[model samples]
Target: MKRSSPANLGAEKGQKQPTMEEDKVRSLFNSKIWDPEFQDTLKNEIAMSKPYNWGTIRDLIDDDLLRKVRKEIETEIHFTNKETDIYKVNQSGDLANLSGLDWNDLSRLPSLCRLREILYSEVYRDVISHVSGAGTLSGSKMDMSINTYTKGCHLLTHDDVIGSRRVSFILYLPEPGKRWKDHYGGGLRLFPSIVANVPHSDHSAKLVPQFNQIAFFKVQPGFSFHDVEEVHVNKHRLSIQGWYHIPQEGEKGYIPGEEAEWVKTNTSTLAQLESNVLQDYEFPKNERNILPYHQIRHFDELLAAQTSEHEATESSVDLSLLSEGELKYLAEFISPHHLTSAGIHKLQSQFVTKSQLQIDDFLNDTKSEVLKKLIKTDELQKECPYESVNVEAPWKTALPPHKWRYLYIDGKSHENFQTEQDILNSLNNEEMPNYNLLSKTLDPVKNNTETELISVATFLESTAFKKFLALVTLLSPLSEQVLIRRFRPGKDFTLATQINKNDLLERVKGFVEAVLEGTLCLTPTDGWESGEVGGYELYMDNQDDDDEANTDIKDAAVYRSDDTGDSVLINKPPSWNSFNLVLRDESVLQFVKYVSWAAKSSRWDITAQWDVKTVDDDSENDAE
Candidate 1:
């Protein structure tokens, strides 16, 4: 064989030399990115950051290459809108896994592949490792997804603590030259931690994104709570979301139990107080603890005074056309239809048949208009202080925000418990704050002009209203609780679940819950159709496997999706002058979906509950 030159020998083995163009493409990242001084500065910034260790880099990549990459993504990728409990956004189903794609696939998206290669190159990986102090991230285990948040899209709070993730990042690619305004609202909001696993209610820091900028942080489990604020207006916030994982077996920093330890420390679970203080905080506490005999007798005497015993025993109680005095009190808030005989008959018949009633225009037009205007003004003009420490008297933030968050007039006492220990102590002391006092206190503060919310609550708690409820449900109310609530836009919600039942309260037939809601939808933008932006109240039949065996099964609040044939009774949105009444037997699950920041206004309502007595069907049949 002829003696071959070195180049000829390499060609014989099918090896190709790197071209000048390939070398230039590989160096698409900023040269200064690899400088030691730059890396140290980034590291220091992350170390000193508040809420958690995080940092941002502007113009992280070569300007021309990033622009080309953005063009490729916009033209070549298909995106689909995804919605779940955790987030809502448009996402590209095509994952950025370069190693898995064949040459044929790579050829179709050359710029994207090049961008991915440069981002995961060893030099960049080392830079990220040094800055995050995450130690030897796995370059081979690339994880990234492209997402677009248009108007109304949001990602709820969550800590990126799952699996072997060491760092998380997002690279923004909005319109190339236009600046994204703060009012547009798609900011990365970081939350402070209250304890090991609990995050504070409000976000402490927000980073408004820009084209060619990247925000990143060490994924510190519970300490890294963050969320994407809803995009407030019509615009697209495109980004590439990715994570750097801990080193694999052959890579550096592959500690065997590090991931497991992180999971153990950051796993989602109820706080100690949530499990132990149910009776003290939740409604219908000790449901079996019937109203005292004297109290029931007192209500009975009131009913007897209104109607003769013979008239009360008739199939229908004459609740229509209340005395002029009672009607006048009710007319202040109640709709004329509800005060009429025909309306009461219609509602009573419906409640008897379905155990639920929804009354539209529940409040008179005049009252509804005034309340709506007042609520709209307050929601628009008043700043809602979310944390309990910031809330003023007459308006208190609901406690243990892990369960719910809102401002409410509980009408009893004001007890602001700042710590979990304080809550536990109060529970142990059996302290029950009376919301009635809160209502009274609010009256004087509003200059004796009781807020429309207070007026509604007052009417609901009045003995006449209770009698009206009794007539509709054919039950005798023994005791009741009323709450005037303001579910702040973007900050309040109650998760899907059931009422808490007391074994002692099981002796009574059931309880009644009524919500008179007026939505002050002030969302400057539309698209809150169906339940997309949430804020809807939902009710479902409780699916308890051992319901029959359990004495208080009807009062049990537990719910499961897998239970066969469970069904929903109602799903209604917040409306002006609407009233919903549900007769719960301990087996109904209900919840208010989290109101989105996109909502125009707060969800204002009067909520009330009554423990009532029901005649046993068997005893009634025997007497008949």
Candidate 2:
């Protein structure tokens, strides 16, 4: 590749002083006025800058000297787009082990050493000291390589509020003497402050470089937002980027723990922390399905009782609820293709109607035989559907009364609950009749039976019941491919208040949105309404409830009759659980697929997967 020199458009010359140190400081570094005071002044001047605005001194390095350094780096260095980090790098040359590389390694590359010498010369030292207002002059290190942003390349806005970095600098390297034309692209665009803490959408300061120009800025967290304008032509716009970390010990103004102190004070959100360069690989492993600390402890305490293999064996069979015959019946009903319309109609009439379906009748049906066969073939039937437990030969869930209560019971702290009277008081609380009834259903304490019964009715009116309906839809025998688990009020749920009805409903909506975005393959057209659920037009009559109500269980199951399509248990199929498990283990694949599909540029593809309908008159024509 042909080497290019750093750009220095509209270079201004500063007079060299009599003393050698003064000469270097005056010409090689930015002027004293443009250091800290200039930054503060610019912060105030740029109304576009947010409250946390800061800028670096431009023209710090001599243009002639910088051009030479840029040429050397461009010719000698190698580059690779990390396939890992979002950035690219030349790791094997002078910048090898850059994060831990010593500053002295620049000697290996003569041009880089020369560049450093000019950067930290005595004159520059005074300028830096005056601008930074720091007493110490520690060794400066350059670790990154020249990056070329060509056609279609772009970076989003973000603050460089990472650990210990005090200042950031980039030296542009394009063809020397050739004006990096405005239309040719590749300009350093600086954001203007919008408020104290945010930046404007459009750029306020643009540095279009010639050869040997250098741009520097203070590393202001949460305020600095800049991007390199993408090059439209095939030409490369290269730049050497690096950071100046906080001063080391023995340097003036270097506090022993200042770096650590700053980091401790600026806490990142879980989302930002996961994006750290060093922590990216470990993030998914640590984050996926991560239960809160309390939930983990609760599970640990509950599991502590099973000390022996005998206890584990005893916990598998649930004779009281689902016996051998019931398991056999379940296996039959769960077949992917076995239950067609006729079987569905027969089963709904023979067993499901009147809510009089006995477990024996459900088990004896021919469809039940399908479920039985599945249970017999499968070796890993979990007890708590929410939890995975091991079984030896026949997969069964133990239905021991306390074990049942332990897994399904809803128990939370109540202020007054020490003795029998306390328990009675909790049952009598006007706010807790439903909870009291469920408590009675599990243990059926002799006292306060009437209040508990009334509480059961209250429970039926709750949103949790609706959530349970949705979960049952997921776990139904006909759709074993779909996995569902309840977000228990105080246990499985997070990110929202467990007991807040509105919050819980919002969570359900979010879950629906995520599934639609990720798994449901959609076919979209323009006429679709914003929240349309089904793929195409729905001939739903906007009549009274009586018109919509089904006369019986079979009627309710027939969601629509015009389309002879088998009533789909789900709107569409979700990604296989096995595939998701693989993805959870392999982050690289997950990221590639996720970025390709979930990125803003490809959001339309996701919308298409859900079969989003269009509102246009021709939308009906398109569906056909």
Candidate 3:
């Protein structure tokens, strides 16, 4: 490999020519790194590694020089905390194109400029190529950034399969000589792919990084799944992340169309994973497969009994004031205000116009106080038992931490999987865990419910409460699932997206298909001011060009920082005794943002969903 001149050093009009001192400063890498024997050993190790081909080298740079570089970076560089759907970390602006910096810029941080050159030098590139067998790397086409993951910062699962990328590497610069402990988290965890694009739920390997160590891997599209574990303590995990690109034109090993070919193959693998065969693994898992005939009949009977008793009224019905039995059942948890005639009228009118409603002080004062106290006690007193195998019953952690990670009552007894293969096999067999059985077993009213979680689930699932949902939405409930969720600080989130619709399911007469969702929030602390520290439920209008009618629906967002046209229909933050109800069509996107580590307590909520039937327009009119 031939070394290219630094991008910023070449002479411009009235600028001084490159000097010998600059060249000497750039050659700061450890010379022993270029030895043939070392390179060969690294190559063999990478080829033999499990999950993926990756290797790490210790003391790859001159220690004194690296220390100097780290000091310069600490004193001179300004970092901005950046957050997005994929990552949350403090980072400096791009350091890759440092050659474009003027002399005045370079003069202030000479060590950083030299460090960039040393990492991208021909000698270092050759060694990297020999070890990883990633072909020729570009010297001129540089790409690198400095990032610091302090407490609670994390990067979720992703393959560094972006444009023109060939290899990826991270050089750690944690406090020198003081070993970065495993319990402090911030390890680079690697996931094994089930197939090309499908990654398993958990990471199989992890590298606990230290100062002066560089971890590099060939950038395998779809297969290179990795994430930075959330830093557990108030410590900084600083590193330089960069990529070696396929050689550009005029560079050795440059092949026309090579980059394009890699991109095409990567995109095809992603498309493959999105096919119907893999829908079972997707989050929200296949649109609540229809209930069995016996189960449906049971729910139908509940509705039928209610229908026989309440005669059709000429004016709008008050869902708040239900029959004596129903109101009594609901009063155990539901707020009196929400059940009032005026409150019911307000909620019904909002839902009629907007398809969603948010209710605060959702639970009656006495029940709300008990539930909140129980939840707060659980959060403060109970230690979360998260294990790779043999996890405790009633609560199971949601998997594929790339998507979401929270303790949820799957409504079933917890089953443990010892390995990625065990999980993959379970998924392949289509073994849907019986969350309903778990719910039934834990229902406080029905069984030995030892906790508020069980009591909440039981209340949400009561026939009377389901009837209340029907009255408010004017949609008859058929099948339902209720989950008591605990989103621990620094541990959980769900990304925004619409549910997949099953077009094949037949629509029942006098009914349109919809999912009725209700969430009763029990977050016990403040500081969830807006969307910051997350744990906010957001609803956005689905962008679907196929629906011509929806084209006129302005693009919007709930928690938008700026007024761009994306429509955000609703945004609700975590609050005590708050409840949100949304009647969703297939065209609405919903998600709860990740809770930050700074939260004083976990976000507690009882989530319920019902597959419902909409009444015919004439019948609705008659009921009104």
Candidate 4:
């Protein structure tokens, strides 16, 4: 399941082999594997297993045979490096293709080919079914693959609910006779469910696997949530991961339309993604509420009248857009260079060329120094809260771990949103982001710790800030949302996702299916350049321009987002006092990668989004 795409890693459907005697099948496995007393004990353990029905077996295969099989794999197979939003590892091509190999191919990997036959053999399936109570599994539907999780490799949490998989198993092939310790990482972690479909953030159970042992569980939709812990040491955690599926057309337990009906119920979360169904369930929705009434009324008309429909260039700053008093207010937070004509002209050229811009030292030195010290002090002294009860009001946790989970200040408090109704109440009677109001009300002396944060946030929400943005992007903003966010090390991440353009399209007459987004990263730490420890913001092109779906994506719901791939448009790691601005459309999928537990500190940043209208450039084009 930690693959780039869905895989049916098995050989062709196996026909029932009535001629193969029970003795012959029994001889293929370890002498202890098929013992009725041993299986009965395993069955009882599985029935009482918490989280889900899962069990393990040691020395499942014959020792000499397995050793030969491992040797063949080493000599014959080639593993390819893969990185995705969810996982990273090196894996061989589907072992299912092993069954279809020509005579020449089979000769090269004879032991591997022979091992596959024994595993899919009908008698073996019966043995597995009996112990796990998985009634009548198909010997044909063997989906498996060979993979190795070396240093830094990992898989995130999710239920193994893709397609019609009946059971999931992992056979570890670490060095023979060696003990894999818990601290070495690469453990198989299982999470208990808060409810039937929702899992708790922390894992309650873990498996520190051993050589030649296989861990297995039934594929229970919503309940079987697990993840592979990242391997920390410079050693190989080689293993074979596979799945058993419902019977095919000719298999013994096959039923009419059984597979199709199963697929309807047990599809990937991705299949229903980008639709309103899943999004409506997302808590603390990414909704950009309107700015405060006073700010809008005081400056909306003047700002609107000042905005021209002309294209920007390396031209002089528009001093008329900001009055002398307004410019003075902005200068306190923004760098003097950014306020000058030369700075504006340089930004104009960058935006015009690539529709994006990145500016270091965007904030004035005094403000930057204050932020760096405040943030670094908090990271060093304050212990971040991990539980929901500990997360205070004003700052809330983004919910539904499958999509995202991070601490954020969204400028309003509705406590926790539990259902669609809760979201509706908030949306219908909208509460806008009022950093200015929060700054005015917060007790400066009592909350001296948060004073500078509020000051920075208030400035970001200022009308002059929007004017600067409009000048740079040559667009007009109708509504905006500002958030102060912290991606805590080891606990926070957002999956790859895109926004609904239709939502923006419905708001204004010329909405243009676009949003001008900005992030002012304030993380104060080092060693983030390589991205091995996660905590990077990435943007990817979702699909081809003509709408041809990516072939690599299948029903199993995984993506191979190699860092160097063409799909990646941007990858930005956490840094101090840097600002990035982009005018992005719906086609761009964006996310913050999971922060590793090994990271020095939290990834801190202030994010902003604007629903903007592209102005007419007809007059400016004529002048050019």
Please write out the lDDT profile of model 1 over residues 57-79, one tens digit for every residue.
98888888788878887887777
Model 3's alpha-carbon lDDT is: 0.66
Superpose all Cα atoms of candidate 2 onto the true structure and report the RMSD in Å to 1 decimal. Answer: 23.3
Candidate 1, residue 26: Cα displacement in angstroms equals 7.3
- Candidate 4 residue 542 Cα shift, in angstroms, is 1.5
How many steric overlaps are in each model, in order? 21, 53, 14, 1
lDDT ranking, high to low? 4, 3, 1, 2
Q: What would the C-alpha RMSD of candidate 4 be, to one decimal place?
A: 4.5
Weakest 10 consecutive residues, lDDT, candidate 3? 1-10
lDDT of 1: 0.62
Candidate 1 TM-score over all chains jointly:
0.73
For model 1, what is the alpha-carbon lDDT of residue 591?
Answer: 66
Query: Residue 364, candidate 3: how far off, in angstroms?
Result: 3.1
* Candidate 4 lDDT by residue in tens digits, 1-624: 112443334555453222346676578688886778988898999999876789999888877778887776677777776766777677776543554555345667766666666776788787778878877787766667788888878777777776677888898888777898888889998977654455555667889988888999888876788888888888888888887878888778899998889877765655455564556545556677655545433343433443441224325656666779878988898889888867876887788699888988988998898889888888888778876547764567776666677887766653554444544675576566666666665667544545677677777777888777766766666667778888887678877877655463464444557778899998899878899888888888876333323222243445654444777788899999999998888888888888877889999888888776654434232111
Per-residue alpha-carbon lDDT of candidate 3 for residues 1-624, written as tens digits (9 for 90 to 100) = 001111112122233323335346345666666678877887999999868999998887788878887887788777766554445677664343354576456666777766776776676788898889889998767667777889867776767665567898999999897999998889999988766555665788999999999999998876888878888788989898887878777778889988777665655332333344445444334345454545344444444443433346423454433568878778878788777656665676677677778888888888777777766666677775544343466666665444556667645555454455655665666545454455555656422323555766767766677666765665666566777777877667765555544454445554455677889888888889756577888777755444332111111111112124355677788988888889887677677777777777888888877776654434433222
Candidates' RMSD to native = 10.8, 23.3, 7.5, 4.5
Q: All candidates' TM-scores? A: 0.73, 0.42, 0.77, 0.87
